[model samples]
Target: MQFFKQIKSILAVSLVLLFMAAPAIAGQPKYVFYFIGDGLGAAQRQFSEFFLQDQLKNPNSQLVMDTFEVAGINTTYCADTLITDSAAAATALASGVKTNKGVIGKDVNGNNVKTLVEEARDHGMKTGLITTTRLTHATPAAFASHNISRNNENEIADDFLNSGVDFFAGGGIRHFIPASMKIENADALGKTIKSKRKDEKDLVKGFEGKGYSTFIGMKGAKAFKSTDFSKQDKVFAAFTYTHMPYEVERMNQYKNVPSIADMTRAGIDVLAQGDKGFFLMIEGGRIDHAAHANDPSGVIWDTIAFDDAIKTAYEFFQNHKDQTLIVVVGDHETGGMGLGMDSMGYKLNMAALNDVHVSVEDTLNDGAGQYKGDKAAYLSYLSKNFGLSNLSDAEAASLNKAMVSADAGETLGYYKLNPAALTAAHILSTRANINWTTTIHTATMIPMSATGAYAGRFGGYKDNTQIAKAMAQTLGFTL
Candidate 1:
């Protein structure tokens, strides 16, 4: 009788504690800012680590949120063969359900579903979307809209009018403008047999009409335009409707085009100020683009820049401590990028990662001018930038042959040319080293990490839907 009384007392106390905790757990403050580095894989992460290491005072220094946790999730085929595309991956991450390769925000049967972002809004949180790609790009649209095909971005962009989120950014101004305002959708037109959205609705005006504060270009943003961002709660920026210029082009052309860091900083600044807190999705969309072209230098540079953005968010959390939860991850891998091959016996010189670069566009247009062949001008430029004064005549001749697309293998172009690839190919055949099967995404698991509040749920092996479902539950919302 005495022992039975003890067991009963313990059970009664445990049940009371459980009942007492339910409301407190349900009412806990919630925040989630997810960053997707498209096509970023282990190689991209390592490359960024080393790229920043070389530039940092202490080589061991990692980006701010680097220590969260490391987990790998399998990236498999959608409706296609072995690999996946950004459209498919985005749909998987956003909707917690996988779709076919070219589809967005829907399933194989074309059923629309609840995205985490929509769930957050339904639960009354401010929402924001930011990316280095065009605003209407596949990744961003996954959370905002659904379509039978990814090519229907214009229609998807229209869907943002009703998304009711607080923030949006990136490029592709042309996509949001109708034919009356644009040579509209030339890029989309060139991709299709019949392009009907060539002249469509203006997504910018659509957002504005929906009560979003919208603008084009970083400078044109009324919020970014003034140093005082008190107006940001009432304003959101959309600088370009299409993809932002590549980092190289941005550095060379616009001089003031904000780095990924700047954009992230501004987005967080505005989003966090609200009483309801917010959910923001920022992307390094071009790291994938550069990787697809197999341009190691371009990809490396973008990876470093992406780190800059991560650092911005990392610092914010550090300041706010437990108030914010930041998760950084990648959607898929691309270009089969291998930093250093075992066959080559040369680890990429941690120092020289970005030393060699030329774009495929640059190599294709080599010796040939935009008008006619300005052979002298092109030769002078190469000599000034990349002349090898100490090569043996025979080897130099072979190299020159390769440079002009006359080599025994793949065409030598900007994406194709880089010192590391050259060295690797010299030791191993081009078929072995830097062997890009296609300019498409590959089936390599992506890494995800997180810090602050319920972060214990992250890391280790998991599936795509698991991430969304876990995050949704953590933030006190359901997907």
Candidate 2:
């Protein structure tokens, strides 16, 4: 009897010890915020930080991402190449598997791989996707769609509607509307028109049929802000027919469009109501677009906009510190961006970027053609928008040449910059001490940061696939 009592006592002490050690094990997070900055890398992040310091005149100013407790360097190579496009990089980050270029949520052999978002749905957790790009764009599409080709956006849109995500906000409504249903917008002064879908399926109506609260365009999104998100089981908000306007252009031209931060907040508000927790992915997609154009001003503003979304997610983390996990990462780097040039040596005047008022895209579309025949008007516009002053004789000659070439109906490659816009960008970049090696994607390692519950899982050097795996593990799912 004494021996049996001793055995029971040992068992009781062991149980007590186990209970005491329980707090050391990290519990599964109730909420996860995955922030993907497409085409953002170390240089891009540093450039944004420098810009903020220069703009705010606060050397101590820091981005919200800088506050994360754990940091990692992520290798962004896809299965097929050292350099990865948004589709393949997003696939690796979402599905814990490397995929070929232009693929979405599939391996090299064309096998469908379930994404972290899908895992969340299977676990009964609410899922949300928010992006500055279209909802069917590469980064967000990888989370919800399984397609052999990323270019099949119409099919991707169909996948998104049936993916069971609770909230989605972005652009690309054209994929949902049939071409026959497209109409000229009188409100846009006939300058803008609706996109036509080939399949003629009304996806907005389809979403409504499935009990989703749908919001389209600026007006619809504004109306959504006034609705009770808690009462809505699912919500979809798309602000543009394609990708949202670049941040610089949006601020100057499209005031009605919602910011990425705004969309993220709305996503959290709606998804947080789920009983089984939630997973949300917010993408600052225009950073990639601007980088692809090799436009420093556009890239800086978009990075700041992305940082604003990070701040929003951080605020939510402050309240649910123990139950939330927030991770910020970039799919890949574009534009081989660097801060210093041979002419500038080591000195960088980031404040010179403030002179840029519009994106290269905006300059090409709006200003270049308007000034094609008028030299004086063109120079004055450059002075006002690009802050170029006291142009040398050679510079003036080059500008005139560009304008003359543009007037002669010269066209460059699809990805090449407009001659007039390129001149302006070169002047601004020279002043800002920013240089770009290529306009295409680079085989660079991107930075990742994490905070809140189980953030340590993301620390150290990791492959992009490991990010998805860590997220899965944190959510108690097997990748």
List per-prediction Cα lDDT, in the order shown.
0.65, 0.84
lDDT of 2 by residue, 13-129 (tens): 999999876532357799999999999999899989988988888989989997788999999999889999999999999999999999999999999998999989998899999
lDDT of 1 by residue, 1-479 (tens): 99999999999999999987663345444557788989888777776676677768577977654667644454545655457778888887887787888888898888887787898787777788888887778889898888888887778767877777777777666666666653332231121112235775766677667666666654453335354544566444655434665565455444455667777777777777777777888888998877766655556667777777877877877776666778777888987777666544654555433333343222323212111234344334433332322345654555454444432345433454433234323422232233444455778877778877666666678777677767777776656
Q: What's the CA error at residue 449 for candidate 2, in Å?
A: 0.8
TM-score, prediction 1 = 0.80
Consecutive 10-residue window with the lowest summed lDDT within model 1 = 186-195
Error of 2 at 400 (Å): 3.4
Output the lDDT of residue 206, model 2: 86
